[model samples]
Target: MSRKLSWGAAVALVAVTASVTVSLTYVYAMKSFNTKVADINERQAMYTKLSEIDQKTRQDYIGSVNEKELNDGICAGYAAGLGNSQAKYLSAEKYKAYLNGSSEKSIGVGIKTVQDKDGNMEVIEVTPGSPAEKSGIKKGDTIVSMDDKEIVRLTYGDALNKLDGAAGSKVKFGILRRQNAAGPSAEAKAALLSITVTRAEYAEQTLTSSMINGNVAYLKISAFTDSNAEQFNNMLAARIKQGASGIVIDLRSNSGGSIRGMAEMLDTLLPAGNTVSYRDKAGKTTVQYTSGPNTVNLPISVMINRNTFGVAEIFAADIKDYKKGLLVGERTAGLGTKDEVKPLSDGSAIILPVADYLTLNGDVFSGKGIGVDIEKELTSEQQALLVRNQLKGDQDPQLQAAVSALIRQGASVEKAPGTENAPVNSNAAATE
Candidate 1:
């Protein structure tokens, strides 16, 4: 079978193999070249249109133009055109500050807005004990101006950046507020209000525990960070070791955080089974996390409010669905999803949503919050006081209701001691 070929035949075979290899290489090279050319052409079209606009503006512009603003606007417009509501283009400076992401107790005025509707910053929330809250800034208030600069006239990111500064610094805000002391209502017309607030550090990821009523333990989860989740397990075990029979988990005003962190905390509490899951666009179901076999045997009670959002809702939902605890307070905020930030070469960036969210039982609670077993409501003032570390003991009705629920679930109660119950907020604490 081992036979040597003739020189002429061998030469012909070599030629055939070399020709095929060269043909494949040529085809691949052409495909790559064509793809690059198409990309360059697309970019050329965009640049051409932009140059035309710039040329016209230079030739017949009316007033002085801020080149920095114009450039930032163009980049921001491109991101906005992507059609993702959560998409926001951060300028170079903003991107830098964002990367500087701090865990400081305080950085800016404690006003949170998720929307820039109608060119005005809509005030969706104000942190308790924050300079904004102390200055009478409440939720539903519209930020019309920052330090006398109209918000509509300035870039939104720039305005947001202005909100951050050193502690003890002052910033002035022009607020357009509803006449009603509560949230927004159609009956009240918007009134212009102005106030100055001093910014200070606030405890951002507050997680602490104490013996509640001698037998029941109390844990306040402000934000679900990995550190906090780990701390939670240790604290819970310590509380249990101290002869605590049950626990009251307060999650009010927690806008939520890392899903992994939430799952970790749940793992310490839930029995072996599926914890939470999510579905992608391709209609495939993926289990996000599952609980271990060991769970602390105790009556659990979770405190929730309307401001409880994202992962916090999932925490509350798991507790409710499993019937492991009774949910006390108002309905949740009902907002959760996965978001990703992509930075561009020019130092600009975009924040966009990448996936949807679902609760433990595979239910979509987005836009609609989970329900509570025991409904205990509070006024805005009371809600603020209850968390500023000012609200405690008999002063907080919701806390009382939660403790009472635990008592009904076979938890032993004793005389309320001089225990400190301070709130940990999901958002960074700031005075604005």
Candidate 2:
């Protein structure tokens, strides 16, 4: 039996309960309000400081300031302050050129270069049949001068800028080439030769495929820019048709590109499943892509290095998650964060991180990059030789490791670890 409360006592209890509930609600509301107020005040203080500085500059600055440059500087500085290396602000003109550059098309003499240890711009790659090649610029040549402008240690970028101009325009260059092409490199004599190259608009070859080690196909993917899926498929199909027992994909310096392109490339091999997902700072995960079911399961080997970034990391991680391939070479660059290119009203743009990429297994390869099953490191000299196209056949240790792994895995590829393949729908993404 329960004891009944008197009406007056019950009324007193109800009043105390209501008072406590109201007090908690008030406290919570105040806490939220105070937080919002603090945030607003902090933002106001920042704006006030900026306004004060702007006023001072306008009043007493001796030099005439270009408003556009000043604004761009501020934007660039703000992005730099974020400490995200990939975050950047691009002016309208640069943004336009950047967009145009993504098609693997260029309006300059086709030669890719890197600043050598000697601080000289050394040619690493010369596009086939390009004006640079036709004009006698080889893979190992160094540009000494461009259009009478000396390409010294400094202002080298300015000198290379001269390579870009109206189509059909000719650019003169002084190239230093080794006289002894096949002799000992340290002792080889070099000569400076002057040549004229025409700047023409042409598509760049993003990938190269060849049959190596008799039954294996080797594909070097330099960058992930333009959608090269069709070409990639054609090359792989040809290799498969030619009895390629294993496939080795070299993404040593492949900074990722189109998410769709990566998906297409991976879809050619990955069975239908959750390939990758995106997780925000709030821990909300949205599936990025579900791979289609039609698959080309093969004894696959993915060769990566410290420079394999963005979607390339995703590609390799996906393969690893599916037990689809052996990742050979160094760990990936681990920069698998997604950035959004937000355009300003003035036609300029800013890129900033929007979220992080998550593998199908809920793995984050952001700052902590993807690891490989076979860890083979490349010496700095050998790495230089690699990007410079100086690595001869059977000389790349990482490639050798990949080839060996593929050969070993070829016989039991289907029996490799991981759950059974499942069918799924569309997905893909990437960066650089």
Candidate 3:
């Protein structure tokens, strides 16, 4: 009877041990599964949330939605999520326009407009011999309406589209011109003018060069397009043949363009050394050096403003880093990242920031822009006066400052044969 009882107790203990082991195994498996599920949910949060919103909108929205626009918005939102202000997604139409507009020729009214503090479109420049110029649309003119539609409510891109159409198409513009705004309140008045302009194909000249003070060669590069390097080299050669004592490069309001073009431009001036470098996401560095024979050895002064950005900033940084030139005017726009246009599966495309750029001294200008050697800040009143003076072929203070600095560096007024010694005019130089 005692042996039987002992055997029974051992059996009972074995059964309990087996039950506990099974329970532990089940709990371990469930914990692992839960962890994996949590991870998947975290990884797919963006996709899941987007899907939810899309579903709700399709089912509950009152208005009929355009799927194309919705898709474009999604693409743009995805790019905006990258947290870079310069990054953007372009729709099919916008992308096509961007590609065509970058070419040597384009059809448009030939006016460059910028948004003011109140989001109104203000004409900053009218191309020479273009329809906008022929229509008497001057710089500093605020565009009140385009084609009878209020332009204040439209985006800059939309306004640009309105200004750009097929050749022979006519567009009407209502402009607000401020009279004598340079003087005190007693002389200021607003006048409205309506004019019609016909669109036509114009050869886009990105760089304009002229002799300032009959000795200093002034070059205003509105943008660094594909042909800019060739144009720049030609301009430089022309100026050299004419015996220019100094050179002033006006990069103000130059939103910047091709990196290759900028590099080529720098190659002309930079000595045989490191000009600039770029870093990738994998911590790899690619260094670019100046390939000499450096031809441009004259005193160079670069003028910049708050509107100077992108590759233009790179140009300024390198000049400042190598002590090759004097940087005048306000600080740059501080955008130094290089972007690449990536095409999506759809017709849309995105401008993605692929790399970060550094100056010759290995300094990055991301949020902090490059500083100038001679900093000059123009007040609103001074800026208004500058625009007025520039339109009248008068001297611009920034250009004057650049010329003065070059003159101080032993740049004398050595006029080329048959060239008159005249005060430098920024408008005439830009138009040339």
Q: Can you give the lDDT of residue 302 in candidate 2?
A: 95
- Give me the candidate number with maximum TM-score: 2
Candidate 3 — worst ten consecutive residues by lDDT sum?
416-425
TM-scores of the candidates are: 0.63, 0.84, 0.77
Clashing pairs in 3: none
Q: How do all the candidates rank in terms of TM-score, highest first? A: 2, 3, 1
Per-residue alpha-carbon lDDT of model 1 for 107-155, expressed as tens digits? Answer: 6787776445478887755776777777888777888888999988887
Model 3: per-residue lDDT, tens digit, 1-432?
999999999999999999999999989989999999999998699789989998998899999999888888888888898899979999988888777776767788988777776667888777778888887899889998888887767666788778776678899888899987664557778999998999987866578788767677878887887667888888877887888888889888787887778888998988777766888788788985464666577999999988898989998888888778899999988898878888777677899888889877777787888789898777676565443334221335666678778877778865422243333333456332
Query: What do the candidate models score in CA lDDT, each in turn?
Result: 0.77, 0.79, 0.79
Once superposed on the true structure, which residue ranges of model 2 sit more than 4 Å away at CA?
Answer: 1-25, 129-131, 134-136, 146-174, 180-190, 193-200, 412-432
> 88 in model 2: Cα distance from truth in Å?
1.1
lDDT of 3 at 294: 65
